[model samples]
Target: MGEGLDFAVKYPFSSAAKEILKSDGFSNITDEVVELAVNKIIDSLAGKSRKRIYISGAGEKEDLLAYVTARIILGYLRNRYITNKFAVNESKKVHSYLNEESGETVDRVAEELGIKTKVNDGMLLVPLPVFLKFTPRSPHYHLINRCITNGFVQIEKQEKKRMIEEAVRKHLERVPLVKKPPQKIISAAKKIINELPKQEIQATAELEDSHPPCIAELIDAVKKHQNLSHPARFCLAVYLIGIGLSDDKIIRFYSNLPDFSEKITRYQVEHARKRGYSVPSCSTIVSYGLCRANCGIRNPLNWHKGRRK
Candidate 1:
């Protein structure tokens, strides 16, 4: 493999990757590429995707094209859940790859993804504005918690890797939705979409209980960028813990709120779990003004267990 193809195969979202792919002029858009894209999505949700998550290891051309094809699939479907899952996983994959790379390579990838930074006294210094732009909803990363000087946030290698993942996610979220995607791309996307299980399996595969109506309503509010009341948020967090959701997954779900602070979210979820708290009873929820319906269940967990919806 040549230098460009090698880099593109490993980092498909990079400029080198785009340039090499453009040189092929769509010649790589074969049935195999489409099929690879479909299988990748299926595997991703199944919790058994390939290590790279974005790139295929078939060969030089297929490896580079698979990433683009997957993006096309996401664009064609226009599903937020699917897009978010794929982007988050792919970005973390980039972070994992960076873990083994030299500091110079990591810095180069950061630059390619548009995170401007400089090295200062053995630390990577990200500009305040640039850091603010890419920091996720996590309070742990906000400048208030970081070391700042000369209008820059000082970071070590590990923090830079994480910030790179957010940068990559931001890039992938803008899936290139063309007026007309290739027929093969659409067909593959539809086939994959059809194969999705009847009950929505979250990317983490742990929201098996999914949501009762009331919890779903709260989720809708969060997704709409509305801030939840403390009571509502506490109720939802405890309910999620009562189910099988890991603390990390619950934190990610809560990250959608308008004013998400990872520090507070982690504390609330962990504190609720440690105390063995249960979801409030239906009557208590009503008192909090969160009960969405008079469903006959006593609690959210009882929504489907010998009870009404």
Candidate 2:
């Protein structure tokens, strides 16, 4: 039933995701993450009892697809980690999301199915580029990242075979084979946070509920740069959270920027990395440094620009 809501197959990726990955500046990142993802696929396939797979697409219809995908993937990961095996639980009913009335119809179907739907706020909302035709880039694409984020969806502009494999490689590091030491890991995180510099701590604390400064800085910087170029800010935004800055912080910070565009937000972070800022530094120094980097450069207070436009 949930699969009716989530799984997407051959959902094309957005231009943003594609452009970012193609950048030569991000070459170093591509290989490392790809290696990790490949290993995960190999490990999972080595002992799988079934070859069954599920798929879906995005948009207003994507809401349903996203929901279904989350449930199926969650169930599969749970089985994989708990019993070291893959389990099949496919949904038989399917629906469409092509019209404006999809919302009410979907609500009606849910009531009829007797399926209690949970408002999965914990599920991450991934933004797919508008270019993707017929489907969305939900968790099924990057199973590794989806696994790491704990059933959370990842936003992407492209769907590359290598990238999905790479995402899986990074995902394995988080799973616990036995009794997962939750307390120990928390303590370790606290210790690591404490060991970080004061600026980093402050920046992290401030960005706990919003987009990181590195992202904002990247956008602001890209706007200044005449050349439409590398690392594509979209990729940077995706990568920033992976570095540890909280989403809450990212959103809150973005709220402050004038004329901020998600498109711009996406490209900046990727471009910044290509320019040599590590993820941590991008979140901390570059995000903050951009203000200083742009200091004293005045626009002379464009009082007439609004009227001219």
Candidate 3:
């Protein structure tokens, strides 16, 4: 199993690993087993294994196992670390905007921060987890950490506060160019300053009838004990909050889900409320196949304007 797993990691696109995994004894491989196998494979590839295991593609089962294992690991990695080109580029923009005074281009800053923003065609790839193999001890560790943690360079409260102070100090040291700093620097400073922690809002029960048709449909589905998809549930939660529904009321709405967990649901709803998350756009709703009514609008928030029934 160990040798086969190692082979899978080495030649992920091959079919040998799949054959081994699908064998009678191994056919019942659970997610836990696959995860363990993936970790082992990663360790072997990283040279962390006690003894190197040679993977020869000579045997049929060996080849099949290698392929299957590779696919599983790749899929897991893709889901965990892979993101679109737009997200990476957006992070680059944020990084560039924040460090403008440092006289460094976005690419240079990214390289200095050890952020790998590789774009091929329209796909953006960042080998985030692989960075763990090399010990990184740079002043930009926080920036790299953000790339890994948030999958983007979204300024968090603590970091934002630190950056704001640094910017202010820098400004104080320099002679005034005008009455204030350049608009670009001022905008960036304001952006960082606004990165405060989300505050909890008092939920109100008003705006039920004003809900967009899609949100109304989701609420009805939840009430009827129908299971909603993650995106659907998220949209509904955000819509509810946008329409002034309390966390408790949203919890009640989700109570009938087949897989409902009270603690988890409450936490998610409260988090959305506190963070002031808004409903997804009409296009997103349509992509989820949750948009039932035409509503003749681009935004879900506006769906209730003309039709309040």
Candidate 4:
């Protein structure tokens, strides 16, 4: 719990968040998640805490995505001040201690947020809650944080005692309705399409140029593979994004589909390749069969393995 506990915050504030939240209409789940995320950040930064935060998402997938995004962004802000320039002429003592404890990556994000490191004698620990819609072995549930619902956060011992006492004296305040989960996060994507000016989208894309080349490849692959019109493909794209595959690779794999009965086999192989999955694995073959059955359009190339009798 050393490093993991460190990632949890004394206050879990958002003054140092990297994600910007705005209202836009689109049907993608990710959009609404960004909104809930912003609220959480704002609340945490505003000096608010809940004794028991209950998050009931529509499904485990959405729940995990929202949770992970929140933690990554929150973690970044919390650590930004310690590593980055916080105060002019401040001693480098805190920075050195953090570096010695956590790796540079964690320290860097903290530095960006302007946090100073100090020892806490009595730190509150929170238990992360992640329910599994899929098996615990599944990557999505396994890698994501489950703590949004019933997790305790650390604060100065004195501050914690004061807050607990005040909470007991006064009824725990209910966060505004605005902080509640959206009617539908999927619908928010349409809002993004309607309101986000084309120029701004282009600007964001352009800004991503500095993002790793692998990500660009993954995006390309998704655009290409999306031609198959199978829900499995979209699901696979989501999985690939989780694994950090470049869009270009996704597009390249999609481009390789040929016309014929063997399309499924090829897809099975190609998708596995993109994921760095080995052939014949139970999950890989099962996914391939699902894709093959769903993609009835027939590949144009019609390539098959082995020789005909």
Candidate 5:
């Protein structure tokens, strides 16, 4: 691999990554590529894909092609749970890699993605609109909560890196549909899908009917296999714990998330429980931009307090 394309291999969602794929004319689809792609999908479901990818110069093409192949297989399968999980997992890997990247490298990656970011007065500034576009899924990055001067948003490097996760997610989400894919691709997808765990959900211990409208909506998202915003996830977990739900059942409910990771979930849940955290007030939830409705209650817990199911 050329040194110029090295960044692309590391940040495979970059334009250079696409150019490399197009320039290389990748069509071999040998057993090695297929197997690697299969494992990529399986690792995603197994909660093993968050670790960043590594590649030697000699192996860059194989590594690059493997990612594309895995994405194509997912597109062909057209499974929402698998697609969203894979994108989130891959974006997380990008977020991990970005933390160690140099300032120049970070700016270059943003430029490649057309994010129009720059440094001024020792602060990294992003165009307000661009920042808002990618940060909708992340509440802390919500524009109204951020510091703005003139028309740009003042963001720390960590927040910039956080934006990349959403950018990468949207980029990967647009994988062109695979039509009439080769039998090799079809077979590989089947194997990948077969290996996916069937949700790993815990025993049913939900109290949804008794939940406030906002909490009820969050529970419904998990049941539908949708991803929650980080704030939303945390709010939901803390509220469940406040309601006297056990660790096991809360973890069980979260298992329905497409990117479910048992260790991480258990750790966060335990940490919150020990802190004796309760659900945020309806006003606080509104500040996080997750208020689902005006239930006329001051707190989520009260909306269902006397209506135990």
Candidate 6:
């Protein structure tokens, strides 16, 4: 462990960190390196390590450390000693802004950072640590913090997944999309989306009336025997659970769908209920064309605020 830690500190911008930042697959990263990074981050997050390690060199070196640190933090391996002055200042600004508004969206913060606000693409473009490094302390710090915190794990996972997907996409670009059966492609896509990390839903019966238009649209679709998309179904299940719906009641919502499998639906609902998975975001719902209209809000969880009871 000591040897691995020394290797990581000396090669802080090691090949593994570079691959992760470049969205390259973790093919070249050794288990030792990952273990070291994880340990350091955990120590930092637990406040067990308050010793800051300063790396002085060209901007490239610092950038690499920032990238690795960001991944560690996203992986829930955070520690106070792993941060630099710039990161600390930016983090402070972010926490301050979040404290003030308590409702800022990641898209809004990404927009402020001059990042494109496309669903799942915005935050993944820049690693959180890199973003913090470049973004100066400003009045919008709180908003940025909220966005970062909200999707912290997703953003990191997205970056890695996007890299692999991009590679696959490039390799498959030559393959004709029309050649593949639409149902097969759809099934595969659905499986991937459903399997990705989900947010935690704070189930509340009061939020039912405020369900986002997309979610409401899904419920109507389910009732009408119109087959719901995988993401749509997952969102509905999560939303229902969050709103205090029981597993059996949620199973009934999916009973009429063409692809409905009583066993599968029940299992999924019970899993989500037990694990506390959150519903999809407004951007994600919009990406699927499930969004009914622009509600002037960033998160689907907050959609109820704009609706009239």
Return the top candidate by lDDT.
5
Window of ten residues with lowest summed lDDT in model 4 = 82-91
Candidate 5 C-alpha lDDT tens digits along 1-309: 576567777788777888887887767567798888888777777657534345556466777788889888988988777777788888888887788889888878777777778779888898988887777466566667788998999988887777777888878767788988989999998787566556543436556356777888888778777788888999999988887789998888888887778899999999999998878888999887778788887898887654654
CA lDDT, every model vs. true structure: 0.75, 0.31, 0.47, 0.32, 0.79, 0.46
Most accurate candidate by TM-score: 5
RMSD of each: 8.9, 20.1, 21.5, 19.2, 3.3, 17.5
lDDT of 1 by residue, 1-309 (tens): 476676677689888887877777777689988887787767655534376443433476685687888888888887665666577667777887888888788888989977878887878798888887777645467456789998999977788788898888778767767558878987887798788864232234454345777898876766653446677888888877876789999888776653456898999899999999989999888876678787787888876565443
Per-candidate clashes, comma-separated: 0, 45, 13, 53, 0, 10
True-vs-predicted CA distance for residue 48, candidate 6, Å: 60
For model 2, the superposed segments whose C-alpha errors exceed 4 Å read 1-161, 169-182, 198-304, 307-309
* After superposition, candidate 6 runs with Cα above 4 Å error: 1-210, 305-309
Predict model 3's lDDT versus the native. Answer: 0.47
Candidate 4 positional error at 115, Å: 31
- TM-score, prediction 2: 0.18
What is the per-residue lDDT of model 3 for residues 1-309, given as tens digits with 9 covering 90 to 100? 665554443323224434545553444444444434444434322223222234553343433443243334433333211111112222322433445434233333334334444554444334544233222222343343454433433333334323333332222122222334334333332332244222122223453465767877776666554446677888888877776677887777675563456799999999988888878888877866788888778878776565665
Worst 10 residues of 2 by lDDT: 84-93
- Whichever of 1 and 6 has more lDDT, that candidate is 1
TM-score of each: 0.68, 0.18, 0.33, 0.19, 0.83, 0.32
Flag the better candidate by TM-score, 5 or 6.
5
Ranked candidates, highest lDDT first: 5, 1, 3, 6, 4, 2
Q: Can you give the lDDT of residue 112 in candidate 4?
A: 37
